[model samples]
Target chain A: MFEWNAYLIIIAAVAGLFFATAVAALVWAVKNGQFSNLEQGARSIFDAEEPEGIQQDFFPGEADEQRAKLEKERRPS
Target chain B: MSPLLSFFSSIDPKARPGIPVKVQLSEIDESMRTPSILFLSAAVCWLVIGSFFALVASIKLHSPDFLANVEWLTFGRARSAHLNAMAFGWANNAIFAVSLWIMARLCKTAVRHGGLLIIAGIFWNIGVTIGVIGILTGGLTSVEWLEMPPQVAPILAFSYILIGVWGVIAFRFRQLGHVYVSQWYILAALFWFPWLYIIAQTMIFIEPARGTVQAITNWWFAHNVLGLWFTPVGLGAIYYFLPKVLGRPIYSYYLSVLGFWSLALFYNWAGVHHLIGGPIPVWLISAGIVASVMMVIPVIVTAINHHFTAVGNARATWASPTLRFIVFGAMSYTLASLFGSGMALRDVNVVTHFTQFTVGHAHHGVYAFFTMVMYGSIYFMMPRMLNREWPSAALIKTHFWCCAIGIGIMLVGLHVGGWIQGMMMNELTPDGNPKYTFLEVVHALVPWLFSRSVSGVLLTIGHIAFFVHFFWMLAGPKISRYREGPTLLLDSIRGEGKAG
Candidate 1:
């Protein structure tokens, strides 16, 4: 029978393990350049230019271009 | 519109396929700036209301006679007013202003016809003003947090729908790409708040749920409002601010994804933890406790990611007002979440519940963690909106110190006071009756109360200073200034600030 005390301890241990793995993965991501540009990521959608060497593959068709034109016309002069 | 087309458009454009991305003011393309200005003004008024109510409530704790026992300004009404004004009025309005900016930037679209949003802002202000008046007039519904009376509640809810419709429309017209973390939080908060608010109001106010169910439901509603609504917005801010201030990318996208999913799944059941040891069923409480402790996983993950993101960039703590508030908020989040989980333990709650400890916990989350993060967001945002930097770094420094010290002192006083109160309550007399006199507990808290008031004064001063700076910034005096390099002391000269 798993007593409440034992269950709690086990759960806590599992939580600790999960936390460790998460931290390790985070550090790995940081090294891999996940957080290199904060403002750029948030603003990328609005700006037309791309970061050099980074290729964006979204919006591959004419409708996308049409929407872009509509958005452009709405911009403040 | 075809169903498929409608669905595609309905999906937030921020989720559309990739485009070239860069961080610049130009990226924040919006059709109208008026809604943002209106929301900002609302935020300032709400800040005053929230802090003033907080002072009233805090003062009442020590001397119930401080205000001559005014019926309308009773502790019950004042406390609820303080929290609701802060959460709904101040925090939500600020979120509206910032989210509009972020959504437009992320979606790669102008806030298509945001003129409607300005009207929505006007409606929101009216609703909040009426609601606060209702609370002060003893029109409270007797529920914690959701205390607005029926007459005021409908107005508030209606206003929310108008604003929410804008958010939905904005999401639908967004440029396509993978949904970003901030988008997830904003949209989820928008959706979850109405669902929770409306359902709870209907069930509690209209239908009148059965005994104990109401209590359970009240706790459920209160906790979720914090978790589902405020927490998402706060985290969304952290997601934005950490990278922006530090000039880095989030450390781990995969980890963030996991953190989000785990949080959504684990956070809902956490409301039950507040009911621990209440008349609620043991199983329900146990489930809540489990979820509370399990929250450690998400909190730790967020903490680690945020902390490391600013490791080498810690110098920015002094340079950037936004970074200072945000970093402080991020640290507080770790402590509050951990503290919450600890309090979920039966041993801790048995003593700490129904004491100043609960008050401490509430402020720790709402003010120290949630409000601080929002402050950071506002600081980061205002310059962009006003097209001018803050006029006085001195005022910002003063505000930061006052708030930081004020909250620190208040939390410490409350925690110690509550522990003593809890211990006294647990004592038993030889006759098997309660041994501790209620007066004894009350008397013990006197010093703590005085300390709390002192801290309240500090926080109030900070808020007033912030208001003055904000007002001056808005008026556009065109003050000639240069950055005073980061110095250990205000008077001392140091090197240049990083961003400056």
Candidate 2:
């Protein structure tokens, strides 16, 4: 007789659907270019403070030397 | 991986954009310095405490009477205490530190209200302290993941909101740029965790959902805490640190989008796999099983993205202590999650359910995957925040090896042993009786259980070494300049990173 609870399942489905719908509505409302310029967000975490080519956490006496060396190596001879 | 792709590895990164001068990195670091240190200190302290509790509980498995006389040290109380202490005390505190720091950095904003954030952190730790104490003193609610007494709920809830609100604030005021994938994860996690926490507290205890609904809700909450909560933050850290440390971008932007949304969609429904054999609806269990299997998509996407990104950067990954731990954690994430999907299969779950196998899986995911990522983030963040290299490279190496080996041993002992235990327990005698007695099962698990204790001791030793190194650096006076190079794992690999 006590095999399973159908009511509980229905409640769960309803709650999930409600949240999904709410999220969809929120996404529709915010047309603020949230997903635009995809690459910019990818690279935005980089700053001039520690530029991409220069590994900030690297070893060596001077960070500038590491960058200079890398630039020189990658330069087209 | 790189030797085959050696030609592509040296492709000119000169095509990449010069760093924009939008945000001051140092200013961001300065703003978060005090709070990050505070949270990390608390996390390490809890790591030690949790280690103690874990050792006690593991010992009880092999030698129950070892602490039989001590009331607070009984198996139930000790296990519960360890879970709460590690989950709330250690893991959450580490998340607060690294996740917030990463969010602020990605948002390109200095945290505006540092004082309030610190206060919220204090309250969060205080709440966890009280809750752990409650569990030890017999106030456990006996729910699987929500074992802390009912009274500790509000304190945790309030503080969690206060801390989480800062991530939202940072995102709200984020610089006008493309929002990075890490931001998506941190933001989702910040919101998803609190909703799960509050709903769990209410449904499971406060206003009891009758019968198996409570049990279902409990598993749903418990499972998703790892799925929705820890997994997102861990993956986000990998996304952030892997690229940053390797000096590259992720392999594909589309893959990131695929990984994030698929995880969100599938992981929510996957929690019911925890209740497979229990008296839940079969349809519900089936839905959960499908979702768990579907998790393979995001897992594969993440693995490909990270693996390609790290291909040419193997030397760089090795040179930096941060990436060493991170690479290990990222690999663990892929392994454990895939194993988890398999474990959720009905056939597998039948054998593994209520066995030590499930316990082994928990550590595989939480310790091997999540905790190690947090440790890497700390390695990355601490030096930047303090503006000084770690005090001792030797100690850092010690920490890494100890933790790596310890968890490795743990994964093997528990999984292999648990599988054998499950098989033996499920075996039936020829005359239609259970073959293995409960006592026989116990006797069989002794060696594996002893290995777990041994692993715990190793982990505790690592924690002490880490504790000493971290506090030493935190307490030491800041060096005025970088006259001496940042500490390196090996000066032998001269041209790779240690150019000087």
Runs of candidate 1 with Cα error greater than 4 angstroms are: A1-77, B1-32, B429-431, B477-500
Can you give the DockQ of every candidate in the order shown?
0.03, 0.25
Give the per-residue lDDT of model 1 (tens digit) for B421-474: 888888898988888799988898889988999999999999999888878777
Q: What is the interface RMSD of candidate 2, in Å?
A: 6.3
lDDT of 1 by residue, A1-77 (tens): 34444433433353355346445645654685645654444443322222221111111122234323433443444
Candidate 2 chain B least-lDDT 10 residues? B7-16
TM-scores of chain A in all candidate models? 0.48, 0.47
- Residue B293 deviation, candidate 1, in Å? 1.1
Report the C-alpha lDDT of model 2 over B166-207, residue by residue, as the tens digit: 888777767745677888888889988988888888777777
The deviation in Å at residue B26 for candidate 1 is 2.9
TM-score of each: 0.80, 0.89
Residue-level lDDT for B20 in candidate 1 = 33
Chain B alone vs. reference chain B, TM-score for every model: 0.89, 0.92
